[model samples]
Each structure stands twice: as C-alpha cells, then as structure tokens.
Target: MHDLPARLPGAQRNLLLKHLPEPRMLCTMRSVKLLPGTAFFTGRRSFAAGVSKEAEPLKKLVYISQSNDVFTNLALEDWLYKQGDFKNSRALLLWRNSPCVVVGRHQNPWVEANADFCAEKRIPIARRNSGGGTVYHDLGNLNCTFFTSRDEYDRKANLEMIRTAVWDTYGLDLVVNKRDDIEWRGQKVSGTAAKLGRDVAYHHCTVLVHSDRSMLQKALRTGGVKGGYESKATISVPAKTACLREAEPSARVSDVMNAIGRVFLQNPIEDKHGNTVPSEAGGYQLLNPSDYWFPGLGSTRRDLASWDWVYGKTPNFSFSRTYSLPKAHNAGNNPQEHGIASVTVTLHVTNGMVTETEIKENDSFSQTGGSDLMHISALKGQRFTEHLLDAAVQRTVSAAMNAYPRGSSGNHRAFSPGPRLTQRSLIMESERNHDPMDREYVNSILTCA
Candidate 1:
C-alpha cells in the first residue's frame, strides 16, 4: 500500500496520505489508483482521452423516506426516477409502509390479492411501475430501492450489499438465489423487482424484517376459485418466507434499516478469492414525501392511488364464473320445478372495462327465454364487479320476462331492473341509497383502496 502511494509524485502522494492516514486504511483505498498527473483517482475506468476528460467520481447516497404511505413512497420513487439526475451517482432509498399490498405493473389485483378481504380489512392495494410479483407491506417490512444510471445499474451488486449487511450486522448468512431473492435457510427473506428506463434504472426489493407472516399470507394469497382467469398477466410465485427476526432474534426493523443504510453508504468492497470487506463511504439524507418536499409529487401520488393506474392498467383478461340467479331474478320461472337456475358468466375485460359479456345458462334455465336473458350488451363498457353480478342477472331476467309475460309460473311480485348503471352512476347511486353494505361493495370494486 505504501509502495503504491510512493509510485505517485510528491504532491499526489501527500494528498493521498492526508486522506488515508493509517497504512491499513491506504490498503482499503484500492479504488484510488495512482494515475499519472491525476491528483485523486475516483472512477473505476481509466481516462479514455486524457486526465482532463476523466469522468466525475460516483457518489453513493442513502436516502431514508419519511413517509410510510405506500402511494407516497411509490410516487416519490417515480418522481425521482423521472426527474432526478443519477449520471455519476448511485442511490439507495430505505422506506416502510403502513399495511398495504403492492402489485406489479402487469399483474392483476383480483388475481394477486383477495379484494373483498383487503377491502374489509381496509388495506390499500397499489400497482408499482416495475414489473414483478405482488408483495405485502407493513411497518415491519423494510424497502430498499437502489438507483443508478442505466449503464451503471448493478442489481447483483445491490443484492450483495444487502447480503453483506445481514451477515455483518446480524451474523446471519443470506444467499442471493437464481430468482435474485435473498434467502436464509432456504426461505426467502427478501424479494426483488426492477424497472429499467432509457436513461435510468432502479432495482427495488422488500426486506422482511419482522413482518406479519399471517397478514402477508392473507394479503398475497387469492381466495375463491382460480381457474376462471385467462390472461397473460404475471402470476406471483409463492415461496416459503422467513423474517430476519426469526433467524436472528435480536434483529429489529430499525436495526436492519440502519444496517442497510450504513452498508449502502459505505459501499462494500469485495476482495480477491471472493471475500467481502468494508470500503470508503458516501452521503446520507432523509427525504420527506410531500408536495413541498418534492414538487409534482402529489400528481404522481394521485395517479398511483387512482383506479385507472392501479386496476385499469391490468393486462387484458377473461374471467368465467357460475352464479346462481336469485329467486326473484328467475324470469317468472318456478324454481321448485326448474331446480335453481344458474348462469355461467364469461367476461372479456379489456383495459378494465367490459368489452364483451357472455352468459351461458343450463338446460333448466334454457327452458325459459334464455336467449333474451343472454343479451346483456347494456353492460358493454361498464367496469367489472363480481358483487354487481346480480345487476346483470336482473337486467337479463327483466328482458326475458318482459319478452314473454304469460310464460311465468311463480307467484313472485313484479320486478324492475331500473336504469342501466355505468361505473360512475353505480357508485353515486350506492352512496345516495345510503345502504352501508351496498356502498362497501361498490367501494371494494370501484375505489383504489
């Protein structure tokens, strides 16, 4: 190490010695090579043209988010990726959110999350700009997003830093698997997803510190039957997950956050023969997610929290479900004689709106005016809601009964399907009706939350 510095001129050697006083510290400063006529070498590459054209040194940054709202953090990330400069700098953002479920860009929320359950639990669901599987987040989980220029983005290096942080801080050995997930004892402790833009790219991951496993399972696992969906959307691969606290009893969310922040700023160094070591440091800052802090961030947050981006962005898909029509919606057919009439509803949704709706009835239902009941073109452009499925039944059944008034056998009273309701009118009517359950159902499907 001393010899390397001696190779430089007197002024350069003196400056080098000033920064790195101890001999051992000089050895750790291997990134600072002795380039001729260069006072302090920083970048990994040699100067292409001359010393005057040498690029600026890479600046490592660790930013801790002040907001725990998922939408705010997501918007902050989006804003930084679109607006911030990372030409000669790398950033790592550490954040956590209140209980929420974040789905990937191309993933379906109905397939990725249990909507009715999440709605009842009041857990907001959001879709990020990145493409990957869905993940459940809460205060117990820690999120780390590594940002760099498109050419400088190194996902493996970021994962290595996280792996080294866990090993160094908690003495827990974690390995980066083929899927780029961090695993400990064959159980996932972290999940990775990334987005690569033309000029910028970011690799963000979730670190399960002491997250609620039960809630994670409930939030991620979709309930009800699953075979109806037919789409090219990305499906989440469920893995056996373990938390950092489970492996190291002493580990806490704050401790892991600080450890990752420290590791990120220090920028871990790898030695020959594949050994890890500590190296030089960088800057750290705490970022607050607000309009005052980040201008134009409010609009991005609103978009992320909007239904158009969250659910409307889902890939085109078809869903089929068999629903038993209510006795009143039997189209004047006697249920005791016809056995309960069930309709097979097949919906083709494109851009979150119903492009086509096909309802197939059984032989018992076909005995009545099933053809009239199948023509539900009125719901052509409406937003999807399994809860409002009964509306379709009523619409079709009213048409069937009105087509043949004397075909009725039941003593049921007169029924009305009322006016056709679009997505906006459905919510407004639900609110105006002041029915708590109806409003809750509408909110479950219509609201972004």
Candidate 2:
C-alpha cells in the first residue's frame, strides 16, 4: 500500500474532500458503485437521507451518472425527457464526457468543425438532439442538465442555478449574458442549450471546469473555404472561453458538481409562469447508464451512437468552390510553354450525395477541335466530398493519359496539356501542393454541408 502525501496544497485538499460524501449528510446521500456490464432496471433507490420525521414529499431529484461517455450521457438524457409519468418531478443530471465534440442538431459538422483534426485526434463529433452552437467536452468539463415540464420550461431560471451555485460556493460572480451563457469577467465559462420534447424540456449547459482550452479551440476550428461558402446550416457563435480550474487552481470537478447539487437540493425553483416549487434537502441519486435500469434505453443509445442519425440528419446544402490547376506544357516541345486554367465546381448535395454537379472550365483552357467537356456524369450520385471528387477526376485523367501519349502534339493527351488538360491536371497539382489552410478550405467545400 502507498502512504498519503504529508501535505496536499490547499486547492488539492479541497478537491479531494469535494468528492467524498459530506460527513454531516452521509445518512441522506447514497453512493452507488457501478460495475461494467451490469444490467437491471431497478427503480430509483431512495433512502431517508436527511429526512425529518415529517419530511414532505419530494418534488425534485438529482440523478448523477457514473459514466463519462458522451453517447451514453446523451442517451440517458433522451430517456429522461421521454420517460412517462414525469409529472411534477424535476431532475438534475451531473455528467461529463471523456473527450468529444458535440454539434447542434441542425448544425453541419463539416461547416462547424475540423473533421480531419477531430479524426486525427480520435475524438468523435456528435450531433446532440438540441439546437446550439458546437462545443467541446472532456473530463475537465462538467455537464449539468435541468429537466422540467414543457409548460414550465425556463432557460433563465436554469442559468441562475449555475450563477448562484458558483457565487455561494467559491465567491465567484458569474454574469448571465443575454445569450444565456454563464460568463466570468468577460469570458464565457458555461454555455446553455436546451431540447424540448412533447412533454418535457431540458436545459443543459457545459461547465468548463478544467477542460483543455487549446484542444477545445482546435477541435471546434472550422477554417478554409476562402473563396466563399454559403449554407443554411447554423453558424457557431465563437466566445472567449475560460475554465473553472483556470479561475481557481483548487477547483475540482466534484466541487462544481456539489455546488450545483447543494443549490438544487436546498433552493426552490420558480418557472417563468410564476409557479414556485420548493425542494427539501434531498439526496442525490448516482445512477449508471444501463439498459437494465431503463428499458428501451439500449436502442436509444445505439441510435444516438449511429452515424446515420448524426451525420445523416444534416439538411441539404450547396457547395461551390474554384480549384486552380497547374500549367500544362509539352516537356518535349517548350515544356515551359503553359498557361493558367481553373475548374469551378458547384455541387447540389441531397442526403449527403451529389445529385447534380456543374463543372465549368475557365477561359484559360479551351477544348480541342470542338472536343466535348470532360464528362462529369461519373461525379453525379457520388458522395459530395473533396476527396471523392479528386478521385473521380484522377480516374478521368488516367483514362485521358492512356489514350494520348506525349509527342502526339497533345492530340492524344487528355484534353491535351494546355487548354485540354488545363482543368484536370491543374486541379490535381494545386491540390497536391495545397497549403494546410487551403486543404481545410477544400475539405469544407467537399463535405456535404
């Protein structure tokens, strides 16, 4: 066994104690130990923690998940929103994901994020069931979800919980901005978003407790498409973000969680419609995201984790971009004798597939002997992406190369190297030499936003 450190810093000490059950109220609070592959739909286990001999009926409950998987947490949120018989009950879910980026339900991942960077880092991008700007999550982040009936849904009221909790616990004042975001000083520390179901509405916010700010910025970086990109997809509102850990060195995730829990348990809730409900000092339930505990939750989890629901749900969009191709020259005859040309592409994407494509060659290149334009029929019905488009062009170029060899006076050359091969060859070379920023632009346009 290892011995404890002689002394932990003040901040570290606070963090260690924050995770433990408050000694004064251990009898009221329940600590659930979750094991892997455990299946059982056991009803919420409620003990008489802090219950007076005449304790009033409980109107609200706090369900904290032991899991950190974003997909699992999202599935649990969905289940809670749809759970039948959710009458006067209120719930606060304290959760955090390992590491992931979640986009809004209607936001286009291609337009709102750097897919290549996220993929390289092995961080999955999720499209939550709510409509909001994209946000990044990791262990240092905390997710607090407040559930209320659809009739009594109030966003401002929820933000207040975060505001009051932080101020009361750490003496940190949080400014609730007009956008409903929690701000400290001038930087956004927490962002709020909500989803409304038929019967329930839940407002969930991301608390930047100790997130890697650099990684968060990198994951949500959406660059490129310099020429011009237009889409109906939701645009993200960039904010100067701050973390609780940055604000307070000793700040632990547990501290923030407990602060919110204490406020949720002790304070009364008032809706926008002038209805106030008081909650006693109630026990918070720690639950594991298990299908056994919540029937049909397994299927919900699968669907949320599926690609079709996430990427497939994006609305149709048009992608238009111009590609610069390399100069074509007959190396045998004045290899330097070449001019500039371009390929302008406008793709109409429907259901993530290119339904119609318009490929236009610029004035730099001209067809030979009334030669028809490169047949872009192959491009139709293809996945509207940059990589796929380049592949398609390469196929056409290969075919042209095979038909025509150099010294044929560019006759056999696919569209000949000059005006004939201008569009295809130029695009291929430029893409090969594309700068990282340019590649990001290309990736943005190629995607089916």
Candidate 3:
C-alpha cells in the first residue's frame, strides 16, 4: 500500500488561494484558498480550502461531495475524467445518489433494467461512460472514484486500500475475489468499473453501505421479459451483494469514506522512512460541480443526463415478445376490462430508436389485422426513444385510421369508434391501466409496427 500517513504531512505546502469572479460564481460568493500542492481547482458542495490559480502540479488529493443527485455527482466525476493532467497526481472522489440505476456506456437500457418502473417512480436511469454491468444506487450506496494517469491505473491497489481501511478500522474481514470485487463472507460488498482516456484513466466502484436490496434487485432486473431479448449489449451478472453495515451495523458512509481516505493518506510520501506526509496538507475538498468551479462541468453532466447518451448509445439490439390485445378494441374501451387476443411485438432498435418493428395484432382493432399496413414501411428511420415512442405511435394510428373508411359505421363498426379512442386515449391505454410489464408492448404495437 502507498505510505499514506507519510505522504500527507506537507500535502498543502504549495497551496495557493483564488476565488471565482463575482459575476459567474453562482454557488460561492467568497474568495477561496486552494489546497496544498494546489494548481487547478473548481464545486457547490463545500470547500475545505480554495483552489490555487497557479500551474504547479498537484500531489494526491481527496474530495467528498454532499450532493446526492446522481446526475450532478456523476458530472463531478466528468471534470476529473476530461480535465486535469493526472500524470503526477492522484485524486479520489466520493459521492452517493438519491436512488437510481446506472448502466454502463455500451449496455442496453431496455435489457439491463426495468425502465418502466424507473420512469413511473420518477427515478432517473443514468449512464456512466464506463464499461460494466448495471448497478443500483441509493443514498445508502457510496461511489468511490480514483483518478490517475493511464500508467498508474491500478484498480486492485485502490480496492485494497478500501478493503484494508474497513478491516483495519472495524476488524472486519473482506475478501478480494478474482474479479477484484470486495466480498464479505461470500456476498459482494463492492463492484468496480473504469473509463480510460488518452492520458488519464479512472476506476470507480460502488460500495454498498446500507442500500435497499429489494429496490436494487428490482431496478436492475429487466422486469418480466414477455418472450425474450437478444443483444450483444453487456449483460449484468448476478452476485450476492452485502452492505458494509451488514458486517458493522454501526458503520456510516462518512466514517467509511474517511477511513479509506486515511489509508490513502498514510501512503509514504517518499520511501518507507520518508519524512513528508501528504495527508497533513491533504483533506477532503467539498465540491458541488458547476461550470464556475470546474469549467464545462454542467455540459458534461447534461451530456450524461441527456437521452442520447443514456439510451441512444445502447448497442443495437432487438426484443421479440408476445402480448395480448384488449377486447374493447373500441377507442373508448378500458383495455383492462376486456379480454382480447394474442399479439407479437418485435422491435429492432439502433441508436435507441426504431430501426425496424414488427407488430402482429392477432385481433387488431377488431379487424382482420389489415394487409394495408404491409407497406407502411414503419418507423425505420425515427427514434424509438422512451419519450418519443408515443408520438410515433400517434402518427402510426393516424395513418392506419386514414387507410380505413371514414364514417365507416355503415359497413365496419371498427372504423366508427374513432371519436372515443382519440389519439390521446390510445396513448394512455398502452402506458397505464395495464400490466406494467406489457405496457411497452402495447405502446409499440400501436406504433403500427
């Protein structure tokens, strides 16, 4: 382990103080002094000290944020990921989220999580620019990120520091499995993933503090798969996960984080007998990520939080599922009140939009499942996105309606119920008042796929 205790003594020797210009400082109003060895700095969380305006290379530093907003916290990491010359510096970021499910960069959101549940509960699904299986987060979960140059990207060493810190502080035995996951007894305590840049790389991991296990599992599951889905998108592997509090009932996130920081600081600044200790100057810098503190921080957060990055980046994938249509085929009918026939929904999405779709309505609109829809050529070029799916469905319904006779009550009762099941009604039926599992199926079927 790095001799942290020996490294922190002079951690702040070169500290310089600087304050943001009054006009752009939305979060802070006072001038702040930068931390020792300070060079570049930037947040709204709280400042242990301030940031230096100098260009000197900073030594190892530690930061802890009070923001639990996943988007904001993840954005904070973005600053470290894209900025700074990490070659000679090591910085650690500790954060937590309110309650969310974060997926890897290349994974499929539809396949990796219960997107419907998250949406219904107003819980956001965030995408981090790293490759790893899905992980659930809540206030009980602590995120630890270590930033270093590509040459110094050592995940095992970082994991060891956390493991050792917990053990050394609480006398708990945590095992490091072959995958580098930290386990208590046989259950996982932490899971890690990383992102590599041209020069800098960061390894971030989730430390289960006292998370809601039920929600974690529910959020990570694809809910109930109607039929099946196949994709090259990374699939999440199941592991027995336990929280730090499980082993030490009294453990707190702040304390655990501090313990880890202590171990990092204890690393010898020089050799085993070196006189310098970086921790003396190094302390937790509280940051609320903002453009004022870290330039472009907001944009990075927005990019990460945007639909394009969160869902559009998903690897091209397909879902083939069978569902049942309601009997009330009429526009004003309550889908849940009547029994209908079986239907198949096949969606081929690329860039998280509808590239190709096949919806076979066994009992479509009480008609013979029209042959006219054959050449509708479908939403092949538009986004099959979460929020946009309904609009697409509206367009499809309009086209299909137009294909039918107007005032057709004369011959086809199917064509006459238009007034009751207006465009809005159809949209709601598929989204609500049905089995949540098949809601998406209903919505896509209406896309006339």
| Candidate number of the best lDDT | 1
Q: How do all the candidates rank in terms of lDDT, highest first?
A: 1, 2, 3
* Model 1 pairs whose backbones collide: none
Alpha-carbon RMSD, each predicted model: 11.0, 10.1, 10.3
Instruction: Give candidate 3's error at residue 76 in angstroms.
Output: 1.8
Candidate achieving higher TM-score, 1 or 3? 1
lDDT of 1 by residue, 190-259 (tens): 9999999999999999999999999888877644227488899998888999999998888888888888
Ranking of all candidate structures by their TM-score, best first = 2, 1, 3
Residue 435 of candidate 3: its Cα lDDT? Answer: 20
The local lDDT score (0 to 100) that residue 15 gets in candidate 2 is 51
lDDT of 3 by residue, 67-160 (tens): 7888888888877777666755678888989999998887887777787788887889988888988899998888999987887787988998
Q: Considering lDDT, which of the candidate structures 1 and 2 is the better prediction for this target?
A: 1
TM-score of each predicted structure versus truth: 0.72, 0.74, 0.70
Error of 3 at 255 (Å): 0.5
The total of clashing pairs for model 3 equals 33
Off by over 4 Å in 1: 1-55, 222-227, 268-280, 324-342, 362-368, 371-377, 394-449
